[model samples]
Target: MTLKVGTILEGTVVNITNFGAFVDVEGKTGLVHISEVADTYVKDIRQHLKEKDKVKVKIIAIDEQGKISLSIRQAMPKSSRPVEIDWQGERNKNSGLSFEERLAKFLKESEERIQDLKHREGRRYGTASRR
Candidate 1:
């Protein structure tokens, strides 16, 4: 069966290489690039997947060369999804900070960043780099 983008299909890892892995989805074949295999940094693909491993893959692209780019990252379940957001953390009006206070805080942060850059430049070029 032909796979389209955003289509999630159950696949079997048929082969593994340093670059990526080939998956067989029913009669069709799809390839999940090493980068698309996981959300976290993957130094080695072997550590995450093995041959004959069943994986759910979302078709991300289909090139003119008939390459099926798949994403296992989107197919996999998120282990820790944030259930509730703490409204106290929000910087909006609900945070009890007035708009003017928020603007002043923003200006303070901007000034701090500018001062930090100036300090870094002074240290790097002995205070003569600005000229």
Candidate 2:
């Protein structure tokens, strides 16, 4: 079968590697990179899949060498996904704190953390060497 981008297909996991999983798709083997295995971070690919596992994957790219890139996450329906938090949006929602107030607070906290780190380094190594 001719593979095309965005086409969803059923494939059997033929091999597993540290970087990704190889799937046999209708006689054509494609790679589903670990990062493409899920919508979130995957520390270990084995945790999410196993050899011979039947999985649904979406065709993401096809290179000149016929190396097919697939994504299992894209094939999954969006409704089942976890809510992704936007840190910037959350900070903006704090309407009570002005930009200047936030900046000042950040600077003060950063200074305190830096001092603490320096103290820890000095204790651990008899003093941190100056660059």
Candidate 3:
């Protein structure tokens, strides 16, 4: 069967590498890049996947040269995906504020975040370097 973008299919893990895994889908091989393996950080590809393992992957892209790019993360159900913070939405929710008020509030929040980051860096290293 021909592979098409956005199609979810079952494939066998033909090979595993430090960067990614190769999956066999209906006689075609596709690379599931390490970042596409899971929604969270994947320090080692083998920690999450292995050879000969059957996995459900979504065909995310296909190049003109017939290279297939798959995503095991996208194949997962939406309910299981990570919750992304909607920063823009949160800002827009306070749209009733005056432009000046909004700007002042944003500046205050930015300064607070910068200080917090610096504090964290100071704990990690000797002293926090000003950005």
- Candidate 3 has a TM-score of 0.68
Question: lDDT of each structure?
Answer: 0.86, 0.93, 0.95
Candidate 1, residue 10: CA error in Å? 0.6
- Please name the candidate that would achieve the greatest lDDT relative to the true structure: 3
Residue 80 lDDT, candidate 2, scale 0-100: 71
> Candidate 2: which stretches are off by over 4 Å?
83-131
**Sequence-dependent TM-score of model 1:** 0.65
Candidate 2 lDDT, 11-37, residue by residue in tens: 999999999999999999999999999
Best by TM-score: 3
Better of 2 and 3 by TM-score: 3
Candidate 3 Cα errors over 4 Å, as ranges: 84-93, 100-131
RMSD of 3: 6.8
TM-scores for all candidates?
0.65, 0.63, 0.68
Q: List the residue pairs that clash in candidate 1.
A: none
